[model samples]
Target chain A: MKKLINKPENFVDEMIEGIILAHPDMVRTPGEDKRIMVRADAPRKDRVGIVTGGGSGHLPLFKGYVGAGLCSAVAIGNVFSSPSSDQIFQATKAVDGGAGVLYLYGNYGGDVFNFDLAADLAELEDIETLTVLGRDDVASQPKERSADRRGVAGIIFAYKAAGAAAERGDSLKEVAAAAEDIIENTATMGIGLSPTILPTTGKASFDLPDGEMEIGIGIHGEPGIHRGALETADEVAERLMRPLVEDLGLSSGDRIAVLVNGMGATPLEELYVLYRKVHRIAEELGLTVEKRYVGEYATSLEMAGASLSLLKLDDERLALLNAPASSPFFREG
Target chain B: MKKLINKPENFVDEMIEGIILAHPDMVRTPGEDKRIMVRADAPRKDRVGIVTGGGSGHLPLFKGYVGAGLCSAVAIGNVFSSPSSDQIFQATKAVDGGAGVLYLYGNYGGDVFNFDLAADLAELEDIETLTVLGRDDVASQPKERSADRRGVAGIIFAYKAAGAAAERGDSLKEVAAAAEDIIENTATMGIGLSPTILPTTGKASFDLPDGEMEIGIGIHGEPGIHRGALETADEVAERLMRPLVEDLGLSSGDRIAVLVNGMGATPLEELYVLYRKVHRIAEELGLTVEKRYVGEYATSLEMAGASLSLLKLDDERLALLNAPASSPFFREG
Candidate 1:
């Protein structure tokens, strides 16, 4: 349980306080609870309010993306626990303008349920709201059951595209449609080499023997498709990319964006190694990689792993992806 | 040792290849060895060439900082080891425009010797070069002997300030002086909660028992001042900041830039917690924080720890610090 924390119970509160203090110009918490962080210049009239929320631990995901040209607000929760519907409603109300709000988040059951409840609550307040769930984890479900799959790193692309659209003064419906389009085209799969330690328990979330890896493990330590001996960087990248390419039906003529994301503990150097192989594989398959992002985008708490995500691109999506954007955790040309 | 690497010997080369591939537009390897990575738009005429290099494990350090308005080139070395003088010389030759080159790196014996040799080699080719060593780790030496201290995260400030100076067409002497100014005004200290396992050796670099921490631990596992039970985040920050303040002679009404850097495995969430306390302490000391950066600026492989760096800023240094800069790892407004 060696961590640079004072009390595990106060981790979330302290983390939020730290974020607000460090990035006063970028993010703010309207209420005293510090559970919902909104952009400093929120409630921009005529622009679709984009909101995303989820459990803590995966930093720069829900909170780090709250800035100009990104999500307008974020509802924060405990580690691996969904935020209460009240928190989500508060975030929606804080960022909602005349154009309405769009709730964008992963397809986790708890999140889906809570967000739905929040949307109902917002509607009662005369606020128009819509939802676009991200289900891009190929290993979580079969292609025919893709809607059942979990959302992983692919959600970043959704945030970028939909946020860009919203920043351009798109309607809530247009933002939701753009987000859904990205969700439909994106696919992600991860291989976990080590388990993350739960901050409260100071213990490993799950057991992973040394020299072994769990392919396709969920961010919350969910069991993967298979557990086996660790392979070379190329082999690991190949295995992770196979399911993603297949799930997206990628081919030689297809153009896409690639993200080699580290799951907390994996080093950027290793992620690049994985990306090198990913690029080679994409080239061999005749897929054109229009943009490549390699780093920790969405991460488990101190989990040693990496996830590969491919977002099949069209002109609109490509333009939005390439659009100028900057957040605490992500930036683009 | 659980790591996502193929072979220890191939780690450095493979990582370099991955960086070059992932950031082709930002970086490129000029020669076949792949040990020297230069900015894609390097050798800008009339601009002083800035170069930094070090071990391989620290991603985004020497390599991630190479870009426009940053270091013009970086020489890659193996994990925690200095690169050969030949490699440094090659990088110098690649990025040297009509103006001279400035060699900026941490203060380490091997690096000092090799960079010196490389500078001599470059001079034979009629290229003028100057060197500025960063020695900002307060824990590594006494105030009277600050120059003997080991350089740590504070070097990033040197890079930011000096790189900005060079990008603005400062002469080599001016850039070196700016870098030296940053090094003289900066102080840093780190605490290690867990040891990082070396990929090549498949073993921890040093032993750190559970529920304990080593204060002032060096990035490469050098012995610290004390080892004891882990303290609360506030207590730890207080201890780390006391020495830094003393070393820098910080006082009321001082303005400074604070960087709360993670040592690889520590989460950004936790870094924020540390930053919250750091901000409070700075306020209590009546010191105004002009700039703040919280995240992994420099890391020790996957070691679980955090380092705090404070750079006393003058108007010129503050402007340089806030200057627009972009690199694969760092970006600014």
Candidate 2:
């Protein structure tokens, strides 16, 4: 196991402790549970609250986005495991203002179960609540069952738009609608060059011989559509971007936001290389690249690969994306 | 050979192309050479200009730092190779305001030789220039020989302090002095869990048997002080942090800034894990960690490891650290 962790079980907690210590000015624990990270000035008098949570090991995914104009709180779980319903409830409670709360996170079985229970618990507290699942991983399901697809890095788009809606005092229904709108237009697909080694087990998530790549791989090593010898970055970019463009029914004159996110172990230089090709592909398709983000916005633990996400943008979505937002890992103006 | 790149020879240029395309608002090529990235608003009338450059592959180190309140320009080179004097001179000519320019970069032989030559060329053009070399990797040399040490991630401190000085309209001499002051008080140490694979050769920089690590390794895979079985995160942190604390002669009342930077392949989670222990160590030693930055501020092309940098801080240094800055890969306030 080539990891810089003290103990397998202590990994998630220790990582959280470090984040709290390093960014106390921006994030904090709402109460005794160290797993719940809330914005330092959370529970604003009347602003809508945004809560996101899922497994750990994906830095800047759930925990790293807690701040002004972003998530109000987050519930963290162990690596690749969902946060418990109780933990999720604690996060919802901590960030709940009188205006109501929104549960925004990726679409996964365990996460859906826990977050739903948390919503029920919130209702018992007389606090209004709404839920929006991010389901942008087109590789996980066909368009006929898009709601069943897994959510991946494209959820960052939903986060920005929904957070901005809430920041502007949008009602819970409107904020949830904003999230749903972005998630509907977003699409993401990834290619994995190597398997993630789970820290607890000290084992690879899956087995693949060297020099092979898995196309449309999920963050947790779920089966993908294809596995073959690795191709060049340009080929990989085309394969990933083509599906996203088609899935969104994008055409000439379409405006979109592009994100080339590095899986944990890929270098930033390689990511930019991929982005270069993706940009060229966009230009050839007569698409207008309104905004771009090329870095490790989301990741699997030490997995060597990258994911491409596209959000077909409209004026409202673009405006919200441009609105002022700040987090420990993300920022915009 | 599992890198996501196109042609090996085009790696650096392609990456530069992607950066310019993705962040056109913040950075641009000063001229026809894609290798020379400069702040979009360079040649700030009477303000001092700062130019930094080194080999490629270290994102956010050279190219990524070119922006407002950081570096005005950068001369890029291929991976692990110094840029040419001609490129450095181009950067100097592009950013030279009437107030003069400061050459702030790492203390590598090839880099120093080229930058010095560039300084000579700048003088011929009537552009006054001063130079400041970052030498903060304590493991590269003993305290008495610190002047000859290799500059590592600690140089980010110099970039911040010196960039802020230049932005505030200081002369080139004052900006160089500010950088020198910060570099003088800074110390850095790193450990490598794996070797970097050069894109061109598809060869590992060095070979280490599985489960062993190189302590105090340089970013480009230079020999370190120790090689042994990988230790737990805390032990490794103590090993790296102790030397920096001692090198800086930090006392109980001393205030300092901490940066736990990831060498490309290391996960952000692991960096935070390392930072947790470093923070604990600083507290135990009675040092006040007034500021903290934990991320991939410097990298070695997917090498799996991390480095810890410390800057002994005073009011002026802390103020500069807190000053507003922005780049494609870095941002501060």
Candidate number with greatest TM-score: 2
DockQ values per model: 0.78, 0.83
Which pairs clash in the backbone of model 1?
none
TM-score against native, each model:
0.99, 0.99
Best by the DockQ measure? 2
Model 2, range B6-124, lDDT digits (tens) per residue? Answer: 89999999999999999999988878999998899988999999999999989878898988889999997999899999999999999987999999999999999999999899989
Runs in model 2 deviating more than 4 A are none
Candidates in order: C-alpha RMSD to true structure: 1.0, 0.8
Docking class of 2: high
lDDT string for model 2 (A81-160, tens) is 99999999998888888999999999999999999999999999998988999899989999889989999999999889
Best by lDDT: 2
TM-score of chain A of each: 0.99, 0.99
lDDT of 1 by residue, A1-333 (tens): 867787899999899899888888888887876999899988898899998999999987779999888899999799988999999999999998889999999999999999999999999999999999989888888889988988888999999999999989888889999999999999998999999898899989999998899999999888889899999988998899988888888888999999998888887878888888899899899998888898888989899998999999889999999888777777776
lDDT (Cα, tens digit) per residue for candidate 1, span B182-262: 999999999999998888888999999988999999999989898999999999999899888988899999999999999
TM-score for candidate 1, please give it: 0.99
TM-score of chain B of 1: 0.99
Q: Whole-model lDDT, candidate 2?
A: 0.92
